[model samples]
Target: MQTRSLWEHTLTFFPQFLAALKEHAPRDATVAVIGASDGKFVLPLAAAGYRVIAVERDPLALHGGEVHLPGTAHAHATGLIDRLRLEDLYDRVQVVEQDFLGSEPLDRLCDAVWTSCSWHYSVNHRRPLAEFVARMQLLVRADGLFGAEFMMPVEARHHLVDHYTSPEKLSRHFTGAWNVLLTLRTAEFTERAHHGRLQDHTHRMGLLLAARTSDHPHPHGKKNA
Candidate 1:
């Protein structure tokens, strides 16, 4: 399956994602979601009464409106927003179609910054990870939160997988910028033969979740001197 299709599959279990979200975000907190594919994460936040801004890099996908998940055809992200008659809910959300790395700074501080399954494709993974954590540190107020869910490897070798980052390497990248809240690895199962074949050849089936420390200094507007 394509990356888009994989994301669609993942969005079906909103409850799983929500459980994690609640652990990190408070009620009525402001949130910024980067690389928000079809808006799956954004819709839930809207429903839960949190202010959300979802940014996507693919204009075609956004304009295409909604993409139903495979098997169940469940609406996700933009579709969920529309199905729930929550377009007005967008008053609280700001969905933008632009490269997350190249986008302008957000207008206000958020309670949390979330990047679910979106950081692996970053052009310069290390620099962007640093910049992303630093940016989130600036976007989230002191005592606020920053979280990410990444596709990582159990071992340090790059498989035939599309993208893979080692947990240890990722931890080193965030060293002082964020606290390691949770790092759980879950197996990814595939019913399709090709997917299973790919998985067999490539060890591409693990997830990682990490949270940013609250005390980190905001990297906003600091002189480079």
Candidate 2:
């Protein structure tokens, strides 16, 4: 399968973006990576010594390495984990191949939550954004960090169109639950072979960072102090 140029660009920038988030994160903090897709962000975080739980939906996407198409890269959470040579880290790192909106229990409270362009495509976009933010907030301790990158243009003719959200819309989603730290919009250009004609287009990429507003009941019944 052919890989989209946009996905390539995203992969290139992910390391730096994640590193920035890590730099600001507390040392040895618990982290949860949603839409982990091959553990690209998970492995590096593990190598950095943070307790991490990676959630993804497709098991094959995690294990099928270079054999899978770029569109499937983020769909598979296991691929990146296996590639990092840190499989034994699973003891400290958990990989859950399931939908994020489902009722599965993610029992650990975390200091950081990382999601790379995955929230917009969840099965329950219509569900109250507050509820979703509340769920994530509960997973993170007071003063913990949350970071995500979202696609701004839903009109982009790509396989991930179903998962894209505009900056304006996402901002409102986080308004009450967290403080917005950063919103960076970068313009990207791509040429697609459509109908045997190369069509060049540009789209916006948005990166967002927020901090959980207040302390919530940690699953372990211990307060974040």
Measured with C-alpha atoms, the lDDT of residue 111 in candidate 2 is 82
* Candidate 1 lDDT by residue in tens digits, 61-145: 4554434443444443333234224445657677766776677767677777777656666463645456665555566665556
**Model 2 lDDT on a 0 to 1 scale:** 0.61
Task: Give the top-scoring candidate (TM-score).
Answer: 2
Q: What TM-score goes with each of the models?
A: 0.67, 0.70
Q: Please, what is the whole-model Cα lDDT of each candidate in the order they appear?
A: 0.57, 0.61
Per-residue C-alpha lDDT of model 2 across residues 188-212, encoded as one tens digit per residue: 6553422112344545567767776
Give the lDDT of residue 154 in candidate 1: 44
For model 2, the stretches where C-alpha displacement exceeds 4 angstroms are 1-20, 65-81, 84-88, 122-134, 154-163, 191-203, 214-225
Give the per-residue Cα lDDT of candidate 2 at 114: 79
Per-prediction CA RMSD (Å): 6.4, 6.3
Prediction 1 TM-score vs. true: 0.67
The worst-scoring run of ten residues by lDDT in candidate 1 lies at 193-202
